[model samples]
Target chain A: MTSGPADAGEAMGSAARAPTGGMPPSRDRGAPTEKGTATPPPGTGQAAVGAPVITDVAGLQTVIDTLAGQGYTVIGPTRRGSAIVLAEIGGTQDLPQGCGDSQDAGTYRVTDRRDEAFFGFAATPQSWKAFLFPSRELLWSGAAAPGRLTVTPDPAPGKPMAFLGVRSCDLHAIYIQDRVLLGRAYTDPRYAARRADAFIIAVGCSDPSSTCFCVSMGTGPAPSAGFDLSLTELLRDGRHRFVARAGSERGAAVLACLTAPTAGPDDLSAAQAVTDTAAAHMGRHLDTRGIRDLLYASADHPRWDDAASRCLSCTNCTLVCPTCFCASLETVPDLTGEHLTRQRVWDSCFTSGHSHLSAGSVHGTTRSRYRQWLTHKLASWVDQFGTSGCVGCGRCITWCPAAIDITQEAAALRVPAPHDPAPGGEPA
Target chain B: MRKLAVWKFASCDGCQLTLLNCEDDLLPLTDQVEIAYFPQATRAVAAGPYDLSLVDGSITTPADAERIRQVRAVSRRLVSIGACATAGGIQALRNFSDIGDFSSAVYARPEYIDTLATSTPVAAHVPVDFELNGCPIDKDQLLTVITAFLRDSKPDIPSHSVCVECKQRGTVCVMVADGIPCMGPVTHAGCGAICPSYGRGCYSCFGPQDTLNTRSLAGRFAFLGMPEPAVARTFRTFYAAAPPFATESSMHSGGGR
Candidate 1:
């Protein structure tokens, strides 16, 4: 076994002296591209630029430790009160190493991972949204007296928050939120500042969770883009190493500080193979080709009334969704009728007051409310935003007190795709 | 001297809260209409012969039956508020199960509570100028209906199903892509289809649309693998007393006529 500073220095020097300016080779010369970096199509998953070859577990710790020294607030997965939460990490010792989690409707719990790998599983119950757009934040405050008014906008500053092991699905979630909050015609300055300042160093998932449907959403088992840097862990001799790649200038700068080697073909191929294995083993599956037509055709369908009966008209699903954007304004007056403050808060269609009118009338019954929610998420969302409002996150299914699963509902209404040719039809 | 009164019985104060919920709209509305007898908002209970009475909730007791008839005689125009007023609210779940068993199971002293074997809608006993659907009606639409009635114009509440509203909003089909169940096609259009936009299914809080095809939709529900009992149970909630939904659910129940 190698010992002391000279051996460590030699390891760094060997990586530095590799022949290739980019990725290093670690595999057979005659191997096919299947043994090389597996490239999925664009918008699916992409390999990170300048992928680094991580040989063993010690190499993984070296990269993580180097980043902590460079003034970045490194956050990674850790067990937090029955759930796996992303929290501040001091070093590799702080990771939920060799631990995995079980997630389902209204429940989430972590278990022993068997292998002490850093990022080996699918989505956790907690989403990245908890950090970006918190449940409650004071947008602005104001006090009025005799037209002498004082207003102060809430201070929303962007800190250098570095995410150590983000999943591909969550990366897509961030993109969805980007469109909702930052990319919209009216930008949310608070959300924008928070997102722009944050740096993502993702760890591609080698295993998918039972609740995961990222493959259907075309999100992923591995992060293709959006992150500044990505890693894939390879365990050998009880030491876990990572296949690292830079996605931006910032990522390149971060990579420069670490003692990672140029990625050989063996490391790249192994990472690709790991990502493929994860993709092939997705826990959930969806067939969406003819779903639109099925719903449209079944309009005036009896299923509406049938499903609505058990629904409690509670708004739990909307509250937990990453893409739901409906909100309303409420104005309250002080003791004197002279002054009032208007505030906007989350509103759900299920709440009885949501539809109450001046004539003292409510519009839609529980059945209609349930129907509206399902149709809008499945059918109408496509017509308006050109994107499904749902990210296939399964949060709504799990959080519903009634135990309603949207996936099951879709499967029950299957219809043949209109465009699919007959068995004997020739190619167009 | 046009009189306008607000009334409530047998329901959560949600519909009444809506009037108060109208922040900027409340001042203008009060300026236009007389605040005659709204017990929830003010202590004022002006005498009857009121021009308009906005009634909330259903008649579930013998006393309520007497009160509605008297209120009807005193007011020229009576508009029912929320599902409780128009469709009997969640209490309408009693329409499916025997009221005797339900009452006995829920209350420790069943005799103490004022008794009615069945919960009936406002339109059942008294004449109603309009019956807005939903657990609570859409505020702007309710305001529009009020102003329109005052102007002698027909209220512009759409008789269209939730499907049209979904089309207008351009939301994706959750049923199609995610296999989510939805009731939008047969349910009345209102509330802008809020639930689905937030990645959830509609629960049909606005009730049935005109020209509903429950038989065919039920076939689809069966196709989706929903059991007969489960489907029947769902239809018997919220607006369970409404004719189309009520009748369809009865057909699935063993006791149905």
Candidate 2:
């Protein structure tokens, strides 16, 4: 958490400038290595971060414990209710062991993975957004002082977080957030602080849900770039192993501490097949070809009304979405108006407050609200953020009360609207 | 100092008690505003021409109808608080049935009981400046409205569905996750999604949210294998007098408790 200025600047550079998931290795160097905290490698410049290593279940725990020993609070997915939710972890036992989930539109089932595979699950209900861009944050606070009022920005939290068992789609989502929060002209200092102190242990998807469309989104099935260390779980021939690759210099240092060997040829191919199977078995598809133009042009389509008829105007899709970063500030004053706090809470386009003005809410109808969300995610976001907002993790599809699939809606909008003839003229 | 009055027409007094339940803020709030006409709490009944009047309960009698008009005349601002004041509440279920039958069943002497044919919201009788909806209004929300009125500004009360608050609370959708028939999709927020957090379905305690798809949620309830009458009863709970829930509840007839 308390890295030197060089390491902090380099860590910020990796995620800030990295294009999409193309996160380059941000080498941490000469940071006064305390308690085995990624012992600064030989050269300051990039060098061999070691080859991919194969580790057993116990080695996985060693990696986790080592990260913790380095003053990083490790967070991982664990079984909570019928869902796998992210929470703080002490060791491997906190992970959702021998558990897998089956998810469809408006339906979910947590089934047994049958084997003792630790990372056998899909994207959790709670994304990494909660850890980074929290639901509610106190940006600043004001108190009445003698003669004048003083306001101070809330300092970012001090915990250095290490996330274990992160997926490829989620990694891409983090990259997207990095672009939104850090790469901008005016950086959110709080988000920058959290993102800089974060380490990701990306896990390849062995069990994807029916709602998953990361293949079409060009983000997932396997971890490619955005992580420090990428792990692929192998459960074959009564062998339980993880083919782990260090993506950053810190990852190599962590791997050196573990009881793992250099990955053999057999281990590499077995890991490839695991991702290949997951890729082929993807249940949904989204055709992203000219999607921005299609949604922008189809604003007046009757399909919006049809969708609104079945829609509940609930904010689930926006809240569950990893990339949907819309927030509103609420001013809270004390009884005598001497003390006040301004909180930034997650806001959705679906809410009437999102479109509020001096007169009233601009988008009063459910159709308009739904349109704003859909168009922003697919079309308008391209103009503002230079990329489509959706990473296609499919939390919206899985969590929607009405089961309104974004992919299906996008496909429905792709169909050309028929032209209407003049009132008294012959039908065209 | 501004004067504040708490009025009751035909409520459980739970909404009035919510003001008293503001234990921490109550003493501080009293310093700023005079508790003028709170007959329930204080014996010292200060006269009206009140700065603010919080009207609770529905207008169920002709005398209450006359009294609300008088309360509206004296108060600078009238805020109808709770479901009874905003919607006719659970008592408004009698609006669907004959009052003659209800009168004979409840009262020993039917002729002595002089009541209106239907229970109606306070807004139905007088022009209410604001309506705070909930079975018993949330303490924080009530305080917000009071503070907003004191500041002469609009209160930050959102009219979005309970599902929004439920999802924000990180509670898994009971309908989507557990196949429970919940009214969160159509009911107004402000309850902090209490029902779903405890694994129980919302009973529409805060009435309908703005632009809610009642028909869609009702259909979802039906798809979850809930009986047609059970679907109707779900919409007919705390705020049945609200037009949206009332209209949706009326679609399914017969078999009821």
Candidate 3:
């Protein structure tokens, strides 16, 4: 691959303007349109595959503005309650450009970066899941009245959203949700409608959160998959810039409307270096060796009783989990019984009311409830989903009022194989 | 008539809320099973001699002990819900320490409080037909168990550990990614590993499964730098008085019951 100003212009000329039939690029930050352009072929950003790199925030704004002009809502991070939360943004001014977050157990605070850098840091409390799956949503609404039981579907996907600064782990979380909600067993039309029409603009993390364990889960410091466009923030000669690469065709079309610099070997390698650093600096680690047998064999071990004693039985941990798919539904009726609407809400196993059947009875004890929750998360979910149910994001530990850390608990039970020494030379 | 009743003794109203939280499925479930005495859902209370009963909370008082026996006598098939009904619950913390002093330490009116010296599950005083494991059972699992029982099929809830659910969900082992403590390996599976699934560690809400090996798990927690007493104290939480958990917690403290 040759790197020169002349070649850069040629590449820029060829990559500009989308080559398909969907919503055209917008002119500002606003709501996205229902329609979207056809995606560019895959491998658009690969060196051998000709990936384009964008270098200016202002230039990036031009592309965002173009999309907004075409009637699309651009959503990203905005300041809220001392932290930058993912929300709807109107322009670059609305973004937390030079700010990052500090996350620890039960503590999340926003801090200023000395340099004015965009996309300078890592994981935040907010993940893309909040937008795609709001806390409360109406699944179906209908009349319970005679001769009329019509169920209304969820609202149409909000004006095609353009997620401006999604992280890799959050993006993967969205995909995981997709599999759960829109799998072979059943399809969630509302989820599909919103997801299909959305645009993803991902930013590669330079500084991972101390609470982040995405590297161990292979989620990433740099996005490897599931993004339309990916970005890397760089600093040179006191200048702040973003190196944007097209992951899909829609990404390439957006690039066409902006001014982008052809990335050199140094730019690409620096990006790689940042990702490697984040991976190596993981704040925590888990020892999974022989975990299955150890947990299975240790079922009657004395540990359950010890753990049950301290557990407050609050559902704080569940509320913060990214992949917890458990949900319950309820129907509320309006006066006169004219209409009934079904609402879906998150439910947790840590509560006392979840187990009731018919008569005034329950199964298991508090011990049983605690044991069931832990066992299912670590072992049984594998049988059901063909994969462990956790992504090791550490949100549960950070937000837990009781400060319970699942990684330490699992490590405690692990009886290492003869070959493996205990992780960190000590149990959790 | 198919009579149904929802009962509580000493627990947070979490399990009953689970039924209420059963958005679309709740009405359909109510159509099949009578909602006779769920105070959380309806003010219309039905007297029991019930065909089926779903009991929540624990027997923390003398009155609770007697009420449980009566509840068992009337119900054809009685099920216990949440950790409180199945184990002693967090209040079972009383089982380990000096109840008198402990109560006085926390309460301003300890003299007025009429709590039992020990918190116990309903099954301790009366026979239970089924046990739904969870601090609050997975509403889906609860539904599955009920629907299956009505149809004469064994409820297909997993008897395995939270580790199994974690693997099935493709969640990376939290113990590996974050050097945090977790109880997912030995805990039962009703919360669908909610805590771990959300990038957090598991706080066993669903109690012990059919078979549990808690000793080795305790060893692991110790290895992770949790002191022995802390380890024992952790086990004594929500299900403190249950046999397996209680016995294990006591043993961890080297204070045999």
Candidate 4:
């Protein structure tokens, strides 16, 4: 419990490297994206369990460089267009410094945080899922001859990835995805291959956007588990530093290579205070208590019709959700007449086509499709995956063109409409 | 080889040019289909009863209406290609106003111009086997249609919204993050979401999707500060005659020209 699991260091299979200054002149921006060391998580980043080490701004830069130098493609949150999106970052120079965001249903705008803290923004539009489970990827390619068809399965993508500034909700979303993809029934080798080589450096959420409800979900203002490292950026009186914790030995190894010192009591308290404030200021909240039962009980409720009236059925909600993993395979024959390829592309339940079978869609109306998505996400997903599909990151709400807040919609389902005879009456 | 004929009505021949754009790919395709009567590609003209006809525009004139029937009579499978052939194109804007007024505004002599009072899709006049959607239909999709026909299979053109393609291509939603009024929610998937990828809102060169709530999307556009007339006009463009879009636009079009 004290500095993670006792066997974590042994699990790393290698001793830590001597500390480096990680200063300029040695800063290589050209270090391509890749990953190296892997350490299994002991799932401990709690103050009650273990104390975290605090480091200065230069230390943040060191972490980036060291990760990059170790052949990891360091993906970090940065200002892209009007939102902070994850992209390949070589160093701290690529971080979203002095930039925060204001988010509401169907709205997001990058704001001047008016301070020089990296990772000041809320959750990004595109999650880490985009990298781990891409929207489109080649499944296989084949060439057909007169009597033979030579098929070639796609190779796992090259280069391991190190994600910088991953959120606590996003980390949970990743785990949920792992359960779905790497569960007992079947394993997606492509997803497994990508996930095995990936490193997570989760940043604690000290600022939740107007659409955020991670507090209500109890996922965090700070990560409890499932990270190589957890970083809580603290900008105190003329002091900008991070209270960093190693969730796994690989994270500890990365920290050992940086010129970081063990944190004093003051730094740990300061870090705690940041998360404490964030926990209070959650802009949105969802009552998850019996949410699945509520949804299951409200199948005949007229609320779905109200939602369907506003829903564009554009697949934006599912696409933005990091946990909603549904894909469609398309067979593409080449102009060469001999070559053919099958590709896996992202699909959503919002589309009637997603339910297309028997030469017709089972869910014809928007009301039916909306009900399927809502119930499946909040209800059946728990039955199937043993967990609620929503991490309450509020991506679905923020990215929805109709400004349909899932939290508000979920709450509304509990209340009976005036026209309805009862909550669970005959279908409207 | 199967004979392929490219025909035109009131279009700018952009969709026909898309076939030419497939320079390298077209070479092998040429082996399967004979380019019998693509007047734009060659001075070549074949007699009646073509294997496949690619019609690229709306039926705007009296002569055009007659010609489309004759083309359908000859062609084995009639594929309506591009926005004009599918939804009456941008030229269909004249459908709203008096054709005399539009002719007077553009033509030196309004009396000299030969045009119908309304430009309507080829489907308005005759049965189309398949309709390829776009202002200038994507060459790849056009090829897919032609290739499918050559194999005697149904063309694999999706009737899904442009948002599906946008998300698949990993183009960040312009309407969501930027608060821009985008036509992507209702527009059919084609053009691979080119406009949003370029940081511009989709102008909906490809017609409306089969499954879309235009009324709901119109509400969103109005919320994004697009005036009722502007919202009406947005749906009216490129796909002016597509029923759902035209109906939605007509609801708001009374506010302005």
Candidate 5:
């Protein structure tokens, strides 16, 4: 199973590959690290690994232009009504410039950052999943005529995509989904095809919202790996620039086409400082120390009831969660009774039909449904995938009408269960 | 091919329009199921004993109550579409008041009018095989129900709240963030969370979910500074007569057992 461009080098050799050098390839940079290790390696400009380059606002625009010139659809965060959503961009003018967002539990508002920083926003309502695994897609078409049935599969993504302004948490989320859709026992052909052809332009988070907790999840504030090009926006004293590093040969080739200068020591330090500040300023934290065991042991905890009291069972947590990958099938037939089409759509665990059985839905109670979701995300996901399902992007918290916080719920599970006294025993 | 029938009672015909609005799939859907009894689409009407029936609207009149019973008896599988068929629609608000007063106020001659004291769901009059929740049911969901019935499979209509759709669409919660009182937690899904995505709270047009905790949501609305009357009024919207919502509204309004 191919994980990224690194694993599929021979297959993607036709495209630009990572240059061979003494410095380890970016794909190997997925090694897990602890807190306080967010700084980039020392040395600046051409001396540093992959030779980090410094580019101004125009240079970044040129990168967008270059990707467009290469026949790639450039997608970035832009203003859509009151929220900032990821959408197709024609040029740099389409990016969310001089804009940021304020996010809290069950609260989200687009605010002017009052600066010229382009990648100022944190997270959007839509993720890169919309491109790779669309909400709705036709699987195949079938036609039957006089005891003969013919089926034709749908074609894969036609145009390649250059996803810009992807945050570190979202980058990790993509990798997690990659493991589910591609690196699993059964590969999803559509997902694999889209992932192979798409180019990722990951941006480090310099402005985390109040709902963000990537630092605790060890997924963000700074990108570790799995990117074609990683960027860190540097805005100071009314001047804006970006520190760009090539993680692959394709990324280097694209950077080579730009007229940006090699990053100096000051630029590198400034970039490092940006990520460090973000890491320190994380708005939320999840102490994952034995979180799996804590949740499993607390299945009958009273906190589930408390959570259920406020819980709407709306499936919001699962839907916004980038790692939740449940789906349902839909079949439609033509009026002639000869033609039919099967489609796949996004499904949520909170839905009663998700766990439907012949007798009835397995998770009939709100408490049971909430328990199942939490247990799967924080505990059982480790058994299914080698990693946790949550990337701590905080979309679930901000999008929940009830403002339910998963981290808070998990933390609440840590509270010691009430002692059940023996019969006739005194109450504690 | 399976014979399908579409019936209506007391509604705006929005749910039927949703079916017609499936411009791309309408032709394909016609091929799968024979339109045995759809007045909105065709002039021809086929005899009953249909394989499936999609009934929209509510039983607001004594005549509608008997009509629904007849529709149920003639169909093998009957699925209710829209809030009207599932939870009595916006007209159900009259269930709390005297129908005599309503008839006298709205009609020129109360003696000529013939109406029921309350509006109720299809299930109240007949046994429904399935219920698709929405104000105007989502076309995709409606198609799924019909397809499932044709295949003799369980329909995949979710009984969860609207919060799921809002989260999937990445819509910021208007209730929690803006302090707007939203019924998304207690309301059913299928509108794809359109209101919240447009910066508005859910109006519960799809009706109450199967496992609705109306009392808890009512408490939250009150905690969010919604006045007692507003909290009661919130539950008395589209699906006001739905049991859970109805009970909660009455409890908060300090009236009725």
Candidate 6:
């Protein structure tokens, strides 16, 4: 069951790079627009500034190989059982080709797109959090003797990682996480180390799922920044090509190794057209205008009761959210009482113990727990990180067993509650 | 060192086995606490008063009822583990039927059998400090409870539904995706959403979560085309006698159906 790095390398060599006809006629064309560059939105992260280049499917393999050769584990989306999951990959074959996902509130299914186009799918269940803030990590281990205790931090991963096919919303999620884990007053050393050492190759989302609201969130359909390289997949005129843009010095170096032609205006327009189509086809929307204030003000809104009725109080929404970061510690001692190891594992606000105090949990009821989660994600997070916690990835909607939509809930808060004819009186 | 003991009554030894299943934590745990009286693991029984007592199974007989009281008196903190000790286990399904008729049919000599008419949780017989809800409690959670006891602090066992674990594990919901009926919304989290990850709905191996909305979840089951009888059957699975689940199941059972 274990796939070695060499197997991935061999698969890359064989599956990718098959020469196909219908390469677009090359013509002299200037850079299409500012959108084509690796420059990110202002104040997001380090700007990735590089020229956009057009490359065929085979050229993309070169990018993967370059990173793999540099001793970085290349992690990408792959078909595992019935769903696409993030896993280590060696070649383009590991990518979920000719596949797309159908997502709705409380539903997700993998379907064939009827073409060999990679990056056709929407969000996978697995997010980049798996790479950055792992579910379980050993913090440190301690050995104790009479009147003495020695402790050592856990060893960091030997090889850094290169994440491939990351979407725009996910990039924003990573940014939000950076603010939470590393940007503020406190920084998680392990997360900082992993983030600093890793490379990110983002893919512009061209096929947004019904559960997607990234366009409304203004995070993407097309990534503006926070990547070493950004790619827009173009499949037209019986040809499959990718318009790759480098976002960093390292990205430019990697692109330089790939044999790609200078993208013509037609190729650039075609790529832009794909993103435009994706933007127009965004399946969901969220009205963020004054959302924070509205949520904060409506503490007594009856919608909390309505949502809680259907909400299982399952922490799935927080767990699948790319930016939600909460952890608890676990201590394990060896049989001799001489050795003890402390570990950190993911925790969720919906859990009873998450808000446990001297007396009991603060938010004990399901209604209160759900309210706390939604308000924090939409409102409180803005105050904490100077940005909304939700990147509008819509994982909360798709993974929710009860099909409770955050957009609907937020919208519900805006409508004024029906006034009771008399306080504590029965409806007239 | 803190002294810990494990006791079992009338049910499967699955919950006790979960403690042994913690191969990595068990040895390390022993370093901090002495395994005072775990008959399943060793014959070397250490006498109480014990620092902590983890009781498994349900009170099914008069003798078992008396034993729990003695256990509660001896242990400083008595915690119930698994669905049986917390909510009477799957055997509580007999609460809906005639126990006398059931005993006569199963036993060669019904007269010789001395059993309570109802299978009841240990909490019904004695004041329990805490309860770990699961058919066979999760090993990781059991470790948490044990360690918390050693430290004289509260264990951080989540009372949220299985949906949270499913989300954290990035497992798609089987109920929503394939129209499968799941108890994930009302069942306590601890199994790590194992069934749902495998593309099946939760069977509620963990008992009812805190403030469970069983009516709403049952309504969803009906909307998904599950019959009333099947909906009732689902709740009556592992923790049939649990208050919330019992009440919800009876609501759909159509009065003695």
Best model number under DockQ: 2
List the candidate 4 regions with Cα displacement exceeding 4 Å. Answer: A1-51, A419-422, A425-428, B100-114, B253-257
Predictions ranked by lDDT, top down?
A: 2, 4, 6, 5, 3, 1
Candidate 5: residue A4 Cα off by (Å): 21
- Model 4 TM-score, all chains together: 0.91
lDDT of 3 by residue, B217-240 (tens): 676577657888888776766666
Q: TM-scores of all models?
A: 0.54, 0.91, 0.56, 0.91, 0.84, 0.87
Best prediction by TM-score: 2
**What are the chain B TM-scores of all models?**
0.94, 0.98, 0.91, 0.95, 0.95, 0.97
Model 1 regions lying over 4 Å from their true place: A1-47, A53-73, A105-107, A328-363, A415-428, B1-257
Tens-digit per-residue lDDT, A347-376, candidate 4: 788777777876688778888888898898
Q: 2 or 3, which is superior by DockQ?
A: 2
Task: Rate residue A391 of model 2 by lDDT.
Answer: 78
DockQ by candidate, in order? 0.04, 0.65, 0.04, 0.64, 0.46, 0.49
Cα RMSD of predicted structure 6: 9.0
Model 2 pairs whose backbones collide: none
Steric overlap count per candidate: 74, 0, 169, 6, 9, 5
DockQ of 6: 0.49
TM-score head-to-head 4 vs 5, winner: 4
- Cα lDDT tens digits, model 5, A1-428, are 10222222222222322222212223322332222112122112342236889988788888998999988999988887777888899877888888898988777788898888788888787677777777777878889898998888787668988899888888777777766565543457666666766787889898998889988887888876667788999987767889998866788888898867899999999999999999998888988776766666777788889988888777666777777788767567643547788777677767677777778788888899998998888777766555677888998888776668888998887776577332212322
**Model 2 DockQ (Cα-based):** 0.65
TM-score of 1: 0.54
Off by over 4 Å in 5: A1-49, A420-428, B1-57, B60-81, B103-115, B137-185, B192-198, B211-225, B254-257
- Cα displacement (angstroms), candidate 1, residue A28, comes to 44
Candidate 4 CAPRI category: medium
| Model 3 chain A: ten consecutive residues of lowest lDDT | A32-41
